[model samples]
Target: EKVAVVKEEVRSAAYKANVVKAERDALRLSLSVQETTQKKQVEQLQTLIEVAKAGNQDYSISNEESIKQTLNVSEQLNEQAHAEMQEMRAKIARLEANASSEIQNLEQKVKVVEAVLVGEVPAKRMRRRVKTKMKAAGV
Candidate 1:
């Protein structure tokens, strides 16, 4: 019964790990899409800046500032995504370790139980005491 419970717990942990992995993959895909979009925007901004320079048009200082701000925001977002991925990876590692430890403990318990059941564990002391009690009772 206890072994079954342990098995169930192991299964639960494995399922949770897979769920986390899927979430991580989704987050990665989101970040990748965001990165591509940001890159396109940056390239378009750079082209506009170059065209303004070539045409001798006075580029608005506000435009430059806006580009800088956008780049900064993108960097921040990338950093945040990277940190979140790291955290998820760490969580998965911890869960795997816990599951492994639980399995080892369960295996050890099963081994002991099997040994006891198979009479590999010594029962001589108990047998001796029981025999003494039976002799005293004149059985």
Candidate 2:
């Protein structure tokens, strides 16, 4: 019974670990997509700036300022995203470590329970039986 309960606890911990891993993977994929989109936007803005520079001076200057502002905002957003990703990575690492520790502890408990069960009659029972037999034998 104790072994069964321990096995169930182990299974629960494994399931929780898998769920956390899946969530982390999904977050990573989202961050990657956001980065790719940001890069494309920056490339497009650069191309526009080049075209503007080759055309009108006044128009180019205004567009340049606007582009600079946009670039700054994009850079800020990217930095924020990076920070969030780092924080999430750290959180996942901690969670993984905790789950690993819990699983190890549970496995150890299961081993101890199995060892005790394998001994058939428990040590105390065997000792008591020995005493009873010794008394009967007038020893």
TM-score of each: 0.58, 0.81
Q: What lDDT is reached at residue 97 by model 2?
A: 88
Rate residue 126 of model 1 by lDDT.
59
Clashes of each: 0, 0
User: What is the C-alpha lDDT profile of model 1 across 13-111, one tens digit per residue?
Assistant: 667656766766776687678668767776776776677667756778787787778767767776776787678668767766766665555555554
Local distance difference test scores for all models: 0.64, 0.78
Winning model by lDDT = 2
For residues 1-139, what per-residue lDDT tens digits would candidate 2 score against the true structure?
9779888988988888888888889888998998898888888888888888887667756679999899888888888888998998899899888888877777766665655567644679775765564445333
Winner by TM-score: 2
lDDT score, candidate 2, position 57: 64
Off by over 4 Å in 2: 120-139
TM-score of 2: 0.81
Candidate 2 lDDT at 135 equals: 48
